[model samples]
Target: MGDKPIKQYRKSRPRAEELYSRALESLAGGVGHDLRRGHPLPLYISRAAGSRKWDEDGREYIDYGMGNAALLLGHAPPEVCRAMGDALELGFHFGNDHPMQLEWAELIQKLVPCAERMRFVNSGSEGSMLALRVARAFTGKTRVLRFEGHFSGWHDGVGKGAMIPFDKPVSAGIPPAVLDTIEVIPADLDSVAEVLEKDRDIAAVMLEPSGASWGTGPLTVAFNEGLRDLTRNHGVLLVYDEVITGFRYAPGGYQEYAGITPDLSFHGKIVAGGMPGGVLAGRADIMEVFDYTGDAHRDRYERVHHLGTFNANPVSTAAGIATLKRVATGLPHERANRLARQLRQGMDSILREEGVAGYAYGDVSIFHVYLEAFPGSGASDRERLVTRDVNVLKGIPAPVVSAFQKMLLARGIDLVSYTGGVTSSAHTDEDIALTLDAFGDVIRALVRERVIATLK
Candidate 1:
C-alpha cells in the first residue's frame, strides 16, 4: 500500500446523506415539501438550539436559513418550548374553540391594527385560501389578483404562478382553467392599473407587502399607498400575505412597516413560532362572513364554509402565543438589521475586491446574494436588461454555485438553497464575523479553482 492517506471531511454529514437516501425510498423527493430539496443532498438536522443546528452526522452549523424565515426567536426557544410543554400536558388538539387558540387570536388582534377579528388555520396556505374565500364573499366577486413573485400557498387556486416563469403554472397538477380566476399582475403600479381596468370580476388584490419570494425586495411605500387608494376606489379587498414577513418585520407586521392597512391580512411563520399554525385577520365587517351566528339568515351565513379539523390545536397556539409575547417586547428588527447590514456589506466588499460581477441586498433580516455578468448599470433600462440577463445566467448549467454552497456547508455556515439567507436574534456578532470570514475564504477558493475568472 502507498504511504499516502485518504482525506476525510472534518465534519461527517454521512448520516444526513444516508437518511435522505432512505427517505427517497418512501417519500417523493425525500422531503415533506419541495422547497426542502436542495442540491447535493439536504442535511438531516438532529437538534437545533438558538441559531445553531447539529446535522445527523454531528456537524454544527450557524443557521441563517432559520426555518425559511420562520424562526424569529431562533430554534427551540425556551419560552416556546415551555409554553408548548404546558399546553401538551393539558391536551394537544381540541375542537375549534380552544382557549389557547382564542388567546392567540386576541393577541394577533392587539398587534396588527387591521385585525379587528381573526380566524386560525393550520398553515399559511390554509389561511390564505380562507382569506380569499372571505374576500370573495364580502366583495361579491369571483376573481382575485395576485403578484408575480409572492408565494400565497400550495393549494390549487392560489398556487398557480408562485416563483416559476411569469404567468405559467408552478406545478403540473393544477388545471389551466383555474388560471383565469386569478388575475396575475406585476408589482408595478402600471400593471395593476391595466389589470384592474380590464378585470371587473376581481374580488381582491392579494400580495406580499415586503415581497419575500423574490429575494426580499420591498415594495415602494408610494406603491403601497397607491394600492390602498386603488383598492378602496374599486371597492375591492386588499389582502396582504404577511406569512413570511409577519413577525419578522416588526411586532405590528409589515402593515405597520409600510404604513398601509389592508382589508385583510394572512399571517403564519413567525406567528406560529416555527410550529404548524396560521391566521387570517381583517376588518370586523369583512370577517363577519366566517362568523356562524344563527342570528344571520341561514342561507347568507352558511354560503361561506370555513372548517378545519386541526385549525387551532393547543400545542401550536401555545407556542405561537409564547413567541409573539416575547417578540412583542424584544428587538428582533434592530438585531436582524444590524446583522443584515454587516453580512451584505462584507459580501459586497468581497465581491468588489475579487472583481466579481454580483450584488447582495436585503431588508432587516432577509438578504440575497446574486452572481451576474454585469457589475454595474444605473439606468432603469440597463438595470432591467441586466436583471434578465443575470436570470438567464442562473438558469444556465454551472457547478460553481453548488460547489460554493458545499464549501459553506463544510465550513459550518448554512444558507437558503436558492439565493438568500435569514438572520435571527440568536446569531451573535461573533457568528456574523465568522460567516463573513467563511464567505471571503470561499470566494478566494472559487477564484483559485477557476470557478470564475475573478471576483471583480
Candidate 2:
C-alpha cells in the first residue's frame, strides 16, 4: 500500500529497471507515452496476448489496460493477426487508394450510426482536428463549445480544457489565440443553452459521448439526448469523440448505445483493431468539404485538403475488418460487458466490506475506481458520486491513488491510469475473480496504511 509494495515491484522487475536506465539516455522522460511514466519506473513489457502481458523480467499480469482500450478482441487475436499477416504478404503501403480501404469504410459505415461519410487519419487527435475543421468549414463558424473534463486528444485546439485547474495552460507551446477559440463549460443543458445564446459564432458542440475521461466523469444518456436537441435548435453541430468507446460500447459505439446520432463523430482505438488509425465521420454534406470538384477555383479554396501518408493503410484496414466482423455479431460485447459488471460489483462489495470511502462505476466494458471520496461523504453517496461532477470524480488525493496503483501493480494487475480499466472478451471468469482478490488486498492495505480514509 505504501513504499513496501513499490519496493516489491521494483525488486521483481530488475530487468525492466535496467532497461529503463538505458531508455533514459534516448527516450524523453524515460518512456514513450506520458501514461507509461510509471511511479518508480515504467514497466517494460516483452510480450502480450489474450488478457495478460509479460514484462521484460517475465512477470505476467492480468492486463486490464488492453492496449489503452484498443484491444477489444484482446491482444493479437488470431483473426486480426492473420489478417495483418496476409496484408503484409500482399503489400505494406501502396501510396494510393486500395480495395481494403473501401472495405474498411464500408464496415464502419455499416456499424456507426453517424458515419455517413468518413475520412481516415493516423490517430484520435488527428480525427478530432479534422472534425473541427470540417465543422467550421460547413457551418462558417469560428469557435467550438466543449464540456469540461471531456478528453478530445492532445492537439493544441482541444488540449487546454481537458485537464483540471481549467484556466491554466495545459501545455506551454499552445498559443493564446488557439485557447480563445474553445469555450469550456460544465455538462449541463442550461450552460450549453447559455453559451449558444451568447455566442453566435460557435461552430460545434463536442464531447466524449460516454462523458468525460471515458466515463470517469460519467454522462447520462438523457443529458446527451438533451444536448443533441439543444444543438439542433441552436443550429450548432454535435460531435462525439468516440476514441475509447468506438466499438467497445457496441458495434457503433455510444452513439448507437444511447440512440443519439451526432452530426460528426471521430473514432480511434478499436476502429483499426489496435492499429494506429482513426476515422473522422458524420453527415455527407459536411464531409463533402474534403471532396474534390472539377472547377479549379472551388477545388483549390473550398476543399478541406486533408492528407495523411498512412490513412487507412492496408495492414491496419485488414486488422480493423477482422475485428469489426467479429464485433458486429455482438458476442464480444456480451463477454466483455458481463465481466466488467462482475468486476464493478465485486470492487464495490470489497469497498463496502472494507469500510472504504469509494465506489466502482462505469458503462459497458469500462470501469473506474474512485478509491477516495470527498470529506464527510461516506460510501453510501452513490447518487452524488455518479452525478458526473468532474471535481468530485477526479478529486481523489494523488498520493492515495498512487498508493492504490502501486499496491495493485505489486499484486500483478495493471489498470489504466491507476484509476480503472477496460475489459476485453479475452478476460475470463477466473481473471475477474483474481482481479477482485488483488483489488481487495490493495484496498485493505491502503486502509491499514491510512492511505485511503475509512468510513466509520
Candidate 3:
C-alpha cells in the first residue's frame, strides 16, 4: 500500500487555492459555513450530479456530507430540480401568499407525526426559533430546557449546549442575559426530571430527536420514551427539532419512527429538498400563537409575529413537495440507511482489522468518524461509539482532523469538518464500496502519521 503511494491532494488546484486566498478578504475563513473551512484549501465544487461531484480543480469526489445533510436524495436530483425549475419559470417569489405554500404544508402534515397546522420559515434556525416562541406563549413559561450536545439550530435561544460547551453560548454575539431564558442540561432522564422539578417555569424540552447533531451521540428509543412521559407529566411542551431527520429517517420522521410524539416540531433539510426553507409544525392548540385572529397580546409577550421574506416561496415549496412525495414511500430511508450500514460496518471493521483505536457510528443515514477514543469512556466499543460527549470532539486539534480529511480527499471522499457525513438515496452500492475502499486507505495513512493509534 505504501509502495503504491497516495495521490498528493492539491497538485492541480492552483485556481482553487488562488480563489481561497481572494475569498479570505471577503468570506471570513475563506468559506461561507464555518465547517467548510479546510487546510491546504477547501474543495471548491464546480458541479455535482447524482452521488459524485467535481471540484474546481476537476477532482471528482464521493460526497458524503450531502450538502450538510440537506440533500437526502443527493445532488441535483431530477425530480426536485425539475419542480424547482418549473417554479422558477412561474416565479421565484410572490411576497404575498400562493397556492404552493398550502400544498407544501399539506404534504408535510401528511408525513410528519406532530404536524397539524404549520408555518414556513427560511431556515431550520428560524423554525426552531418560532417553535420556542410558540411554546413559551402557549405554556406561559419563561425558560426552555434543552439537552447538552443537542443542536436545535443556530438561533440564540437554542444556542448553548451544541457545538460548544454546555455552559456557554455557541458564539459571543449572544447576550449573557439571553442565557437566563434558556437552561442547558444533560440528556440523562433523571437529570431531566430534576431540572424540570427544580425549575417549574421551564416552558419546553427541545432536542434533536435522533440525538445530538444527527447522532454523533445517538439516543435510544427508551430515553425518548421516558422523556415523552416526563415532559407530558411536567406540563412542559416537548419540541423535537428534526432538521436533519424529518423526512430522512422515515416518511413521518423520528417521532413516528420512535413512537414518541412531541408537542411541537421543527423540520428542515429534506423537508425542503435542500432548498432554503423550513417549517414549525405541531399540535393545533399550542401553535395558536402564530394565529392572531381572536386577539393579540393575550399574555406577557405580544402575539408571535412571524414573517420571512422567503417563507414558503414557490420554488422551495415545489421542490419540497416533490421531495416529500418520494420520501412518503419510505424507500429513501431504506436505501440510505442500508448504504450507511454498509459504510459504517466496513469502517468499523477497518478500525479493528487495521488496529485503529476509533469507531464509526450514527443513526440511520447520518454517520460520524471519531479518530480518538471517547473520554471518561470505559463503555464498550458499541456504547462509546454512541457516547454523548461533544466537548472532547470539539477540542480535538484541527490539524489531526485536517490530516484525516486531506488523506480521505486523496482517495476521493469528502466529509464535513472531518466530523462525519450522511448517505443519500442516490448513493449507490458502488459508492459505498468506493467509500469503504477510501476509508481503508485513509486509516492506513492516519496510522502511518500516528493521527490514530493502532488498536491493541
Candidate 4:
C-alpha cells in the first residue's frame, strides 16, 4: 500500500477525474445525489452485470451497492430484461390503463399482508407523501409522529428529524407549517404512548421498520409489536416505510417476517424491480380515499388527488411482475442471506485479528461494519448487535469513513455506503472471500497510517 493512499487513489482513476471535471461544468455539485459526492472524485461506472461492475477507467469491482439495495436478483437479471423488452415492443407508456398493471398489483397484494388496496407512484418519496395525505384525510387528523432518524423520503413531510437537531429541517425550502404537523420522538413505546395520550390529532405513526438508515438505529421485534398495539389503541394509523426492506427481507418483507402488519405501508426499490416506481398500500378503508364516486361533488371533495406521468408504466410493471415471480419462490432470499452471513463472520474475524475496535452485524441479507475508538465491555455481541443509540453507531468521523471507502474502491469492492450494503442472490462465496481480503488490507493500512486507532 502507498504511504499516502488518497494520492494513490487520485492517480489511479484518471478517467473518472476527467469526467468529473467535465461534470462540474453542467451537473449540480458535480454529482446527482448528495451521498454520491466523494472526496477527490466519485467513481463513474460504464456497465454492470450480475454481482459486478466496471468503472469508466475499466476497473472491475465486486459490487455490494446492488443499485442502492434495489437489485435483489442483481443487475439486469435476464428475466427482468426480457420482460422489459417484451413490454417495450407492446408500448412504453399509455395514457390509459393496461392488464400488466393489474397483474403487477396482484403480485404485490399476494405477497404483502398490508396491501389490501394500493396506488402506484414514481418513487418512494411520492409514496410517503401520499401515505401522509391518505392518513390525514381518513382520520380527520393533521399531525404525524415519526421516530428519530427514521427516513421516509426527501419530501417536506419527512424532511425534518432525519438528522441531528431533530427539530430542524434537513433542507431549507420546507415551510414551517409542514414541520409543525410532524412530531419526532425516540423509538420507545412509552414515549409513543405519552404522545398518543396527549395528542389526539396525530393521524399516523410512520417509520422504517428495519430502523433508521436501514438498521443503523435498529428496532427490536418487541418494539415493533408494541408499536403496532399502541397505534391501534390510540386510533392512529401505523405505517411502514419498506423501501429498503421490501422483497429483500423475505417474500413478503419485514411485516411478514415479523408477522406484525401495519395499517399502511410504502414500498420502493425492489417493489418495482429496480425500476422507477413505488407503491402506497394499506387497509381497504384507508385506500378508499383514492376512489372515485359517481357524484362529481363527492368525488371532488372526498377523494385524494393522485396523478403521475409514470406511475405504472408498462415497462416498470413488466419488470415488477417478472421480479416478483422469482422472489415468490423464496430461493433468492436464502442465497443472499447465506452469503451475507459469510461476509459478516469473515469481517468480524478480520477485525479481531487486526486488533481493530469494531464489529460486523446486521439482519437478514444486510450487513454493517462499525468502527469505534473505544471498546468498553459489559454486553455480549448479540445484545449490542443492533443498537438504539444513534451516536454510537453513527459517530465515525467523516474523513476516516471517506478514506476507508476510497481504499475499498482501490481494492475493487464497492459498498453502498461507507459502512456496508446488502447482498444479492447473484453474490457468490468467491465474492465474499475477495471482499474480506480487501477489507482486511484496508483496515491494516488505515491503522498503519493512524487513520483509525487500534485497540489499546
RMSD per prediction, one decimal? 4.1, 1.7, 3.3, 2.3
User: In model 2, which runs have C-alpha deviations exceeding 4 angstroms?
Assistant: 1-9, 373-386
Which residue pairs of candidate 3 clash? Answer: 355-455
lDDT (0 to 1) per candidate: 0.77, 0.88, 0.82, 0.88
TM-score of each: 0.90, 0.97, 0.93, 0.95
Of 1 and 4, the candidate ahead on lDDT is 4
Displacement of the residue 290 alpha carbon in candidate 4, Å: 0.7
Give the per-residue lDDT of model 1 (tens digit) for 173-237.
88777777887666777888887887889999998787637344446668789999888988889
Clashes of each: 6, 0, 1, 0
Q: Mind giving the per-residue lDDT tens digits that candidate 3 earns over 1-456? A: 132232233446777878888998998667998777766567788999988999887789999878888988899999889999999999798998998888888888888888888989988989988988888878889899887788888878876888666778888789887888888877789999999999999999989877777777677899999999999999999999898878877889998889888989998878899989999999988877766565445532557777788898899899899999999988888999999998999998987787565778787887888776323233335434434666554445666677777778777898744568889999999999988888898888777766665534
Worst 10 residues of 1 by lDDT: 1-10
The lDDT of model 3 is 0.82
Off by over 4 Å in 3: 1-11, 294-302, 373-397
By summed lDDT, the worst window of 10 consecutive residues in model 2 runs over 373-382
The local lDDT score (0 to 100) that residue 212 gets in candidate 4 is 79
Candidates 1 and 2 compared: the better one by lDDT is: 2
1-456, model 4: which lDDT tens digit per residue?
345965777787899889989999999899998878877788798999999999999999999999889899999999999999999999899977899999999999999999999999988889999999999989999999998877799999997877776668989899999999999998889999999999999999999998878887788888999999999999999999999988888899999999989999999989899999999999998999988879899799878989998889899999899999999999999999999999999998988788776778888999988775333332334334445676567666776777788889889998888588989999999999999999999999887777775565
Error of 4 at 126 (Å): 1.1
Candidates sorted by lDDT, best first: 2, 4, 3, 1
